[model samples]
Target chain A: MDFKKITIFAGHYGSGKTNLAVNLAFHHKAQGRDCTICDLDIVNPYFRSKDSEEDFKAAGIRFISSPFANSNVDLPSIPAEAYSVFAKSDTYSVIDLGGDDRGSYALGRFSEFLTDESTYDMLMVINQYRPDTRTPEQVLEIKKEIEDACHVKFTGIVNNSNLGRETTVELIERTREFADECAKLLNLPLVMTTYSDKLEKPNMPNPFAINIMAKDIWQV
Target chain B: MAEKVLMKGNEALAEAAMRAGCRFFFGYPITPQTEVAAYMAKHMRKNGGTYLQAESEIAAINMVLGAASAGQRVLTSSSSPGISLKSEGISYLAGSDLPAVIINIQRGGPGLGGIQPSQSDYFQATRGLGHGDFHVIVVAPSTVQEMVNLTYDAFDMADLYRMPVMILGDGILGQMMEPAEFPTESSRKLPAKDWATTGTKGERKKNIVNSLYLDPAELERTNFERYERYEKIKATEQKAECFMTEDADIVVVAYGAAARVAKNAVLAARDAGIKVGIVRPITLWPYPSDTLKEVAKTAKAFLSVELSMGQMVEDIKLSIDCAKPVYLCNRTGGMVMKPDEVLAKIKEISGGLK
Candidate 1:
């Protein structure tokens, strides 16, 4: 069996970064491989790893979260357990950073621990429908801003454009094409595309990995 | 029996419902509880079950009532405002004695409250939700694992008593994740369906399930019988978890997510050379009054920490016969009291210098 490498995800809010991270974690876990997720999203309180912690835990996956990560403006510093996991984990680890330029800046603090080739794959999630970066030029600009803040090169792109549960395959495929174009211009790989399962089937043909919504345990 | 897995409350409830043979679900999306819907939507379909995303919470709960009446094990969920919409249906279901499960991942209330977790629904859940005089079995889960475990118990208790069972949770419990084991499919049993409102065959007369009993005497008898069941539930099913109350100077009382915060505060207080303990009520409707009364005999004061202004404090005071000073420490409107806030209150109430 091949070892699952640690994948680091970062992007602005509504960029679909978490969607990519959660789906990748699920995909690997579903294949009977151990996957661990660290929810580092301390910015957006609503749509973060804290909301979906139980779902990942139910899949026999390990999860670590910051205490009072949400609601408390005084963001507690990252716990020591996160560093231990990052340093020693043999299984696939997915670090879901927050959704802001500050999120990128936050990653710079961990640079001392990260090696040049510690299997780091930084994926910048983009959504064409969102206001911050509707056009390709704007997406590129946001990408540069992230890279500058984190001092890390982004290796891939994930297009996660959708209108809530009403998304369709045509929209996903269109976003996929946009991501492909961005990847070509930036010299980065088109890593993945995500769509809500309510809108489209999971079997889309693409060179990149696909991300679909998994079951949430606390829906009611 | 399945091995115990360290699980959060929301995930546990979802897995436990499946283990109890619940297959049909209808619900709308809400915060602190979206996980339960998400879980049921994915796993229910995989298990040859039905999961539907209703347009509104009202439609979702009514759909649950329909499914339950058709002799199917079903459930629906929501938070505070959504639960307010569900109350009409819940009262009807309770009056008709239809067994079903309703989860309230409680948040701040009265209107479209912020999505931060709060337990302000204590009064709404416990003191007869709708117009008629009726009681639903309310279970308070303090841990993620209990959320799963008690859900199974909720379904069984609902069926056995022919009543609606509610798992009252907060956003903290619903959203937080911990390690949990998935129960094997073989451990579940399909509940007997003799009382369901499925179409009656030739051998039996048509069955009617309704809360409207026109005759006053008959309705009164039904009410009395329901009270009898509630009495039995109160007598036999009062659940509480006490930590280090023996020979403690101060006892802190809390439930659900608040209980967890209090537990941490108590630990911190102990570390600081304060003899503070905690009493957590697992069954909210039964209220664990007897236990509180018993603990009041030795403890100097009872500090009530809640997400509301002072709802559960009244119950604590009443239960303990005012033998001890029942103090209130709370934060409302989707705000969860921090451990520091609770500890400060404990110290202040115990006459310690701040």
Candidate 2:
């Protein structure tokens, strides 16, 4: 349940960052924190953070969706409320950036606001199931792209590896070494590894059990 | 036998091409098909092969043409819209009688459709991808392992026949994970590329690689020659799988991902005491039309299950050209039909048959 006052999520497409962002936003709001979820996803038109906008608002969390999100138009418009997340020191802001270099360019425009990288936590989500981000070197290559575009360093890693609802507990358990290798390569803490299973395993380190409602429906 | 590795269909296809000694690849990135290009880019550089991302799909296939003209094993991969963009090059390749491989990891489309898995390109593949009376050797694969073996064979098939070969897969196959063990051995003996425009060094007549036959008589003759080859190909290179066809009433005709889904429905319907089977076409160009006719003789009806609205069903009906009724069970634009839904359709058809 530990998180920074402001945490930014970014990764390759299908890395499960949106699911994690939504999960964390709900977690903080449930704990009675002033949580705000920013959906800055313009990389993919579908399966984005804004799909949970009504859910986030219903749970007493402020939601900032992309200007033209969920529409046919792909205009790159960053909402003003995205910048205000930085000003509110008492609020727990969750920024769900889009996948890959195409989605991260919008993050660069907010470079001036991210001058203090120490206060804000940037979590690079990795899902090795995706071919492009399958290896630690490939993960580093993608990580570098996001870092260069966002003009901020990633403080930690989140191993949110799964193949939708078909993902099993053993698959999440098996990915720990791969995630550890990637964390070692980046010299960052493996802040959390997510699983959708209801039961928690004993040997899991920094495990975050979550319920993924948005992703499974789309897989169907 | 090579060790088994779980690979996505797109990645495995590219790897299979690499093993088949395909040294040149040109592509433009489009999903659910970009992994093929990405894999080529990552490996081709290290392996001392040529991998170039062209400015567009049109340019990519033209690059394949240039490489094939030089008698090098070449390839290009794309999705539906990107493949549509490469139509000109595809026609040119067919007309020139060049040997190359094109993999279409299909997505939903008539235009710029959604980027989800679909088998909507059945008509484009079987009825010729572009203009002119031509056909590519279209091979539809249903599994990741087949993605490897079929792609490897597609190169040799393209060379043996001096024609382009299309490996038709869908988004689910492209993105799904499954265990695949590429065969270390293949018995396909490829023909020589004597017609290649590689330099003759003044030892023989200079070979020309041209698609344009401006003279009407000569063009007609060329078309006649191509059709002869097509007829021979039709006679020889047809592959299909008939699952539980014996003593079955209803047969489901599908290919690629839809076939796998339909197989489940077929089995489920059988448990419910319906005599249902499935006919999966592995080769789409020289489609398994005869198989449908053979099944049509005994079965009550045939259901054409697809990810598109009644594209391949036309081929099914034409294949039989009979009085037996043919039905369609389809979903378009990236939606996957559930097995239970397919079972319901089968039940409805069974009622009609009764």
User: DockQ of each candidate's interface versus the true one?
Assistant: 0.04, 0.13
Best by TM-score: 2
Off-target runs (Cα >4 Å) in candidate 2 are A12-14, A22-37, A45-93, A115-119, A127-138, A160-178, A196-202, A210-220, B1-16, B29-43, B107-118, B143-146, B171-187, B214-222, B260-273, B333-341
RMSD of each: 14.9, 3.9
TM agreement with the true structure for every prediction: 0.66, 0.84
Candidate 1 chain B minimal-lDDT segment of 10 residues: B1-10
Error of 1 at B147 (Å): 0.9
Tens digit of per-residue lDDT, candidate 2, span A53-158: 7787688899998767755354567887788887847989998887776678878877777777656888999986665677899999888888888787888999
* Structure candidate 2, residue pairs in collision: none
How close to the true structure is residue B34 of candidate 2, measured as C-alpha lDDT?
A: 83
Fraction of native contacts under 8 Å reproduced by each candidate: 0.00, 0.00
Q: What is the C-alpha lDDT of each candidate?
A: 0.76, 0.84
Counting clashing residue pairs in each candidate, in order, gives 20, 0
In angstroms and one decimal each, the interface RMSD of every candidate reads: 14.3, 5.8
- Cα lDDT, model 1, residue B88: 89
What interface-residue Cα RMSD does candidate 2 give after superposition? 5.8
